[model samples]
Target: MIVERLIIADNQPLTAYAVEALSRSVAQEIHIEDLEIAYAQNKTQLNNLLRDGKKTAVVVDYTMFDFTNQENFTIVCDLYQNTSCWLLLSEELTPNFLRYVVYQTQNVGVAYKDASLDSMREALHYVMTGVRYISQQATQILLQKAAEAENRRDELTHTEREILKAIALGKTTKEIAADRFSSVHTINSHRKNIFRKLGVNCVHDAIKYALRAGLVDESEFFI
Candidate 1:
């Protein structure tokens, strides 16, 4: 079993279910916790998590908002460079967005909110093994997109790459912290660098740049 150091951004029932499922089947050493973040918190709970040093992968609800913007996404890319992450989206994802994320955080994976435990389990396995995972329904649509071949030569540092992945998967700084082992302040520092290096202001722009730069390849993306 894989030992996943996990975090949850949403405190909903399904988040609990997903965590339980992962703990039961996929992760041998599962560390499940929650980050309660409001716009007014002194330091977002999620950021505190990211600041921690232990490198652990994260699974997050797609609806969480802290790392919703481009800056925050870049921050996550910087902080959790070695971590793998999963985004449980509210609905089906578009091909363009999917391709963008594939480039931004090369290790990001996607699964629908309604996906089975086994599916999530398999996805985690794939990501940890250095492969990308997209749901079957999203596969053909993602491949159908007009894609540019990836240029590994322009690859971001490993850390920047992971932050990009977290953003692509729709994680916030607060969410990112809870999902991985990093601090909020450190996460923010990485954010600044990610924007500077990628030369983009928001998640959307960064993703587009990553795609255009040949940072991601659609053919290798297995949805």
Candidate 2:
């Protein structure tokens, strides 16, 4: 689990210095060869470093990096199988983005930029060891989202839940009726009941609830 290279891909100078200092300390303690430390101010430099296909560990503040989107960052990470990343998040990143990144990548660890030195060191150790590490702040956001989704699922009846899933899949009332061998009126009534139970007033909200509740996969919902 020796990290041959450590890339600090953050634009903020002070933050990068602090992470570099902490990383160097951990590397020294672990005897990780005083790994080559590189600074990537932008994506091109980051890509070039990763293209070397070495056992590299990266600590990046994605919010400040030039990635066009979270998916763009994911794409870059996916490109280098020999590389692992530790996300240095800021408080401004949204809960959904946090969840998306945590779920989307296997070789990425997450910690806030303001995290304690110990937490940062632990995250570095985990990422370099090919393990996942999520900070307390990010874990709270994910747990809260999971609780809300569970509550939404618990509030709906079986029929209402099925109807909501159908709606999320873009099925019309008529189509749902046809699939269930029921009248369109019955499907429409179930849709209304779903809205009432979920405290939503419209189909779009019900569909959103279904997506969040895990009744429908995100890809299915989008399609």
Candidate 3:
């Protein structure tokens, strides 16, 4: 049987080697579409590539440009809309971020950047078989964030609550900034306030607070 096509949307040379090596173990032929620092340069091409696949799996880096943009998110949503396979390669599995990516991706797969190559390969394999994949660390972080959010209920303000909602939903500071027409620094400041109010120290904690408080739903965040 022909293995499903695997496209790695990364702009790093190291990733080219890593993903290529990983794909070689499962796919008959590994194709690399290395944007190599200019990924966002050819938005049209990337959109076309995503739209062309029938049964395809795309692995995208979390910081891979503005996937949070409404239009871009729409394109990504369209790409994996009904394809049943997609994946995100994120630097960390913080619920605050993954929630957004997962919501956009339709929950295909979520792999951490620091995970073993075998784990990534396994995730790809699972998706091929119509099952979702999420790293262990990602899963734990998600649960913890949910628990923390629950524990800290009344300390958050209405706006702080909304910021937490956005963060847990996986919207980036830049995306939130754009949507709110505020500066990135301002969004970040809001994030800091969220952390303080939630009694958490980082993005992970804020996510837990948001989840626990029902500011954001569990299904809205993953990976």
Predicted structure with the largest TM-score when compared to the true one: 2
Task: Please list the residue runs of candidate 1 whose C-alpha ends up more than 4 Å from where it truly belongs after superposition.
Answer: 1-4, 28-43, 83-89, 127-132, 147-223
Q: How would you encode candidate 1's per-residue C-alpha lDDT over 192-222 as one tens digit per residue? A: 7777665445667666555555445444322
- Best-first order by lDDT: 2, 3, 1
lDDT of 3 by residue, 1-223 (tens): 1224555667676875677566655553233233121132235555666565545556666476445553464456565566635567768545656655554455457888788867877876665445667778777776786567565567667777787788888888899899888999988887887776565666875676566667787877875
TM-score of 3: 0.58
Say which prediction, candidate 2 or candidate 3, comes out ahead on TM-score: 2
User: Each model's TM-score?
Assistant: 0.50, 0.74, 0.58
lDDT winner between candidates 2 and 3: 2
Task: Report the C-alpha displacement of residue 51, candidate 3, in angstroms.
Answer: 2.5
- Each model's Cα RMSD: 16.2, 6.2, 10.3
Worst 10 residues of 2 by lDDT: 82-91
Question: Which residue pairs in candidate 3 collide?
Answer: 99-221, 100-169, 100-170, 145-208, 149-208, 149-209, 149-212, 150-212
Whole-structure CA lDDT of model 1: 0.55
* Better by lDDT, candidate 2 or 1: 2
Best by lDDT: 2
Indicate the worst ten consecutive residues by lDDT in candidate 3: 32-41
Q: What is the lDDT of residue 22 in candidate 1?
A: 58
Residue 44 shift from truth in candidate 1, angstroms: 2.6
Model 3 spans > 4 angstroms off: 1-3, 28-42, 66-71, 103-105, 154-223
